[model samples]
Target: MEEVLREIYCALDQVLRKGAYINIVFSGEFKHRSAVTFVVKGVVENYFSLKYALETLAPRGVKPALKPLLMAAMFMLKHGEIPGYAVVNETVAFAGKKFGSGVKGFVNAVLKKYPTLPEPEGIQKREAELNAPEFIIEALEKDGVDPKTVLRPPASDLVHFRLGRKGKTEDLSGLETLTRSEAGGWFSMPDTRLKELNASGKITFISPSSMECVNAFGDINGKKYLDVCAAPGGKSVYAAEKGAEVTAADLYPHRVKLIEAYADRMGVKLNALQNDALCRRQEWLNAFDCVAVDAPCMGLGVISYRPDVTINKRPGDVETIVPVQKAILSEAAEYVAPGGRLVYSTCSVLKAETEEVIKDFLKKHGDFSIYSYKNNTDFGRLIMPDGKWDGFFICVTEKKK
Candidate 1:
């Protein structure tokens, strides 16, 4: 238990201090230890709530090194299968090793008092209960998302995957099906089974909401297509599989290599290029019959899969990305041939990143207009996290002929 607490301390330090993504940090450091992974994830995912409780109990405040330990201990005491006494004792022992006998007593006293602490009331209570940030709760409320829904963890660890090569879905065993995508080849399966199928090149993991963006493009058989910001190449590979003559581009060479690797594994041919989405190439102007700009954003919609997003993001982060998204969309519009379609998508639900960006872009580009599809809205379709899938906002626009 002490060792797990130590590991959690290190992982939390990286996230809270160094501003690293939790998924990347955990995968690199603690993926081998299932117990450590579970505890660390639980602590980090519910960090805000734990912090609130610890701070409430310790009016003088806890030290930085001690905070992670306390948070982990608090989480274990309340939610984990471990008994409260065990959690308190192990934390004090761990604290003694790191901070001497004096600090150990401090740790013991604080944890012992945690349970008797009065529960927070009203919105503060909701924030602590959900372990979500106040801003997130308020934002969801504005969007009409029940705060209770966003606060609860996802229902399953199932990941969506697109069948890369022709094979029987039944051949993949041990996975429970959640839902099938409207896109013919995609389905959601348990993460373990998805990893197995991905290893054998039988499948590639992609969010179903993302696959819906590709689906919105309709039939692209034999048509020229450009993925303006393609990386780790799920959408590019999907388009290629659908018989589109695809060209995938990203800002960096290493990212383009990911596309190449996916295309190789999937046995599909597509051009992979390293090009900035914001830069216009004269020769490539009006070049493709279909273009997709999956612009990067704060990634609030994927918080279930990547909890680090919440910790790393700031209020101004949306403002920072909105212009970039609009810029990419502008450049993407230039790449579409006359009468061709441009699909703008983001793994974000924030209006600034979604509707506002699209709304602003439409105002600037009078030649283009919104193209509606299933689940359409005035500006675009917003798919919120359904406990089973991540949220995404996808908008399609067509250039005037």
Candidate 2:
């Protein structure tokens, strides 16, 4: 148990020091003890507080390499009933194994000094914000959703049933059905239930909203379709089932391979290509009858499933993703043949990433207009992150003849 706890600490330390995504790290270290599991989650949930604490303890000149472990130790000192001496001994031992004896003394000193550290204003604000980063709180404030308290999941999944092409509704009775079948779609379901659902072969274990989004768009009857940035191919397969000739492209080679595998398993024909949509290559330029750009964002809307996002994500994440979103939207616009439609979507509720990005795209591309089908829908209709589905924004645009 102690060794597992040490590994968890080491993993967390590496994640915070390098700013690596914790999801990747957490998934890799899944066999740790339950106490270690709880500690990992607590450290991640309180990452900002942990970062702030490290900044306070370590000298600016010294690299705060063990920030996650230090932060976890501080959390224990401030909140847990663990003896201060034991915390220091264990954390220093962890540092010795990872960073060597050269850094052990520093680690020991910091843990010993953990309880004596001054209370930070950031911690108070975090507590007030229910452990979410201040930036998220600010963003949510703009949306009028006070995120000071936790929210509850809906009694049922976001959609009671998917709308079939002939208007038949396919009912999904269990939460696991949604996750296994549609993993890319984000939703918060219990882990035990998700495992059971996976074991049953109900859904392929992707996102929570996968089924809802695929079904909502209806099926394509083998018509030509383009999925821009479609590396993981969940939507592509769903479209193929409806008989669409799917062309999925992403900038990354690895992602293209992933899509190819998914297409193979789903028994769908897909032309998976490693091409940047932003470059507007002539081969793909204005060549599709339909295009889907699922632009990336800070993912503020799906915090329930990725509880760590609320703690680790910063305000700058939105700013960083905005240019990429705009570029994708701009490139997607050029790919829609005249009179054809291009769909712009994101699993984010932030105005800057969703409606605001769409507004800017419309401003830049004078030849396209809002398709009205998506524009006239209720403001909060499909984007109910606080309820069943994670917050999602979708807009359709048609190129002018």
Q: Who wins the lDDT comparison? A: 1
lDDT by residue (4-34, candidate 2, tens digit) is 6577676766556665566666666456555
Tell me the TM-score of model 1: 0.87
Q: Over all chains combined, what TM-score does candidate 2 have? A: 0.78
Candidate 1 Cα RMSD after full superposition onto the native fold (Å)? 3.0
Candidate 1 lDDT, 7-100, residue by residue in tens: 7778777777688777778667563377667777887777767777877788787787777778777777878888888888888888898888
lDDT of 1 at 350: 76
Write down the RMSD of candidate 2 (Cα, Å). Answer: 5.1
Can you give the lDDT of residue 90 in candidate 2?
Answer: 78
Each prediction's Cα RMSD? 3.0, 5.1
Q: Candidate 2 — which residues are off by over 4 angstroms?
A: 33-36, 59-62, 75-85, 115-119, 122-124, 127-133, 142-202, 208-216, 310-317, 372-384
Of candidate 2, the 10-residue stretch with the lowest lDDT total is 160-169
Displacement of the residue 193 alpha carbon in candidate 1, Å: 4.8
